[model samples]
Target: MAKTIFITGASRGFGKIWAEAFLKRGDKVVATARNTTSLNDLVEQYGDAILPLQLDVNDRAAGFAAVKQAQQKFGSIDVLINNAGYGLFGTIEETSEQEARDQIETNVFGLLWLTQAVLPVMRQQGHGHIIQISSVLGVATLPVLGVYNASKFAVEGLSETLAAEVAGFGIKVTLVEPNGFSTDWAGASAAQSQTMPEYDGVKAAFQAGLTDDSFGKPEATTPAILKLVDAENPPLRLFLGKVALPWVKQVYANRLATWEEWADVATAAHGH
Candidate 1:
């Protein structure tokens, strides 16, 4: 059966690729971007199979309105790809107040609003899947990406809670955590703070850790995403790219060891 997929940030990168993949496979797509004109080619090619809407996900009203338009056109939304977010590059000390706030507004609140908007519709339908585009930074941290890490961490927590809360309503939530990808995510779409002299060394070390092979190709993710949404039982969390799982595994193992190392102190602090 053909599914109706609503995607945010569909103008380029992974979102655009996934949208085209879905449309090519005979699914109806509601493709949204800040500038709908960027989607003109998809509209031209897919015609009635695609609905291109202009949406700034940070605007709560606009998000709900977009959902309404999607439902009106497609009858029901089977899947929602919450892919509208960008990375903010800076160390915690170098990050500005406004940059931090802007990152949260789009990544956390914008996703929250759209998830809330679709809940009722999915509830009525009794089945829906919500996919949040998070990052490997959500689980692990790196220098010069403090604000971006924080934003993705917020997304991780929010989406995990959402998964549990909406399970009863037949709503499935998945957090797609990708490591570095050769997308505009780290290029044109990224927001960067002015560099601080003190952090120059830290920044260089961070850059030195990355290699040409670190990033996965954006288009290569199409098949993985397609299979993810098609699963009869999708996971609550899915990691994209070859590097994501190995990195996360090491990070998690260290966390577990540290927690166990301090388990006695933690227990004592919770005295009955």
Candidate 2:
């Protein structure tokens, strides 16, 4: 049976690839981006199978409206892919307060609003899949990607709770953690704060190593995602790429180690 999928940030990158993959599999896609103009090619290619709409997930009303329109058009959305997010590269001190807020608005709050908008419908229907496009950074924190890391870390927690909350309602939530992929993720459109003088050497090294570090391919994870979408008992988390797996494992281990090491101190403050 072909499913109807609603995907955000479908104008480019992994979102666009996923849209195309779903269409190729005979599924109907209600794809959205901030502007639908660039999606004209997809519209021409897939015809009615691909319904491109303008959406900024941060706008709660707009998010709700998009879901409503998709439901009306496709009867109901079988899958919702929250893939509308950008990378924010900068140190904590270097990034402006507004910049950090914008990162949260787009990456975390937008996802939350959209999920809320669609949950009622999914709960009523008693079946739906929600896929969150998180990053390996969501599991681990790097030097300059603090804001992006924070948003993803929040997503990790959000997705876990959502999965437990909706399991009884026959809805499933999966977090997709992909590592550095060869996408336009670090392109001119990426948000970057000015390099602080104290971190000049570190920033220079990051810039020089950018190309070499980005090794994963977008298509590499598409198959895993499609499998998850089709699986009857999908995993709560899907970590893509070999490189990402190790890093994520390391992050998890580190977190566990830290908690264990500080357990006595942490419990001391509780006054049990």
Candidate 3:
């Protein structure tokens, strides 16, 4: 049976690839991006199978409206892919207050609003899947990407809680942690705050590493995402890419070890 899927940020990157993969599998896809014009080629190519719409996830009303429109068009959304996030590369001090707020609004609050809008419908229908496009950075902290890391970390927390909350209602939430993939993600589309003078060297290195050649192909993640969509019992979290698994595993181990080592002091601080 072909399912109905609603995906955000479908103009490019993993969203675009996922949309194509679903369409190829004969599913109905309501694909949205901030600029619908960017999706003209896909609309022309896929016709009715892919319904392209203009959606700015940061706009709360628009988020609800998009969900309503998708429901009306496809009857019901069997899967919702919250893949509309961008990286904000900078040190904490380097990123402006507004820049940080914009990051949270787009990556965290926006996703939450969209999820909230869809949950009532999913709960009433008795079955649904929600996939959040997080990153390995969500599990581990790295230098110079604090804002992006924070956003993904929030996603990790939100998805985990949502999975537990919706499991009884026949809805499943999955978080996808992918390493750097070759997409327009690292280009001008990504938000990179101006570098603080003290961190010039690190900023240069970060920018150099993000250039086109350093990432894996976008297709690498599409198969895993599709599998999750059709899975009978999908995992709560999936680490995509060969490189991401080990990193996430190591981070988990390291976090546990650190917590254990600090347990005495941590307890002492609370006067326990």
Best model number under lDDT = 1
**Highest-TM-score candidate:** 1
Instruction: Look at candidate 3 and give me any clashing residue pairs.
Output: none
State the displacement of the C-alpha of residue 126, model 2, in Å, after optimal TM-score superposition: 1.1
| Global Cα lDDT for candidate 1 | 0.93
Model 1 stretches astray by more than 4 angstroms:
none
lDDT by residue for model 2 (150-209), tens = 999999999999999999999999999888888889885489987789988777876686
What are the per-residue Cα lDDT tens digits for candidate 1 across 1-272? 89999999999999999999999999999999999888898888999999999999999999999999999999999999999999899889888899999999999999899999999999999999999999999999998988888889999999999999999999999999999999999899999998889998998999999998999999999999999999989998888899989888898999999999999999999986
* Candidates 1 and 2, the one with greater TM-score: 1
Q: lDDT score, residue 119, model 3?
A: 96
Q: Work out the TM-score per prediction.
A: 0.98, 0.94, 0.93
On the 0 to 100 scale, the lDDT of residue 82 in model 1 is 96
RMSD in order of candidates = 0.8, 1.7, 2.0
Structure candidate 1, residue pairs in collision = none
lDDT of 1 at 38: 85
Clashing pairs in model 2, backbone N/Cα/C closer than 3 A: none
Question: What are the Cα lDDT values of the candidates?
Answer: 0.93, 0.90, 0.88
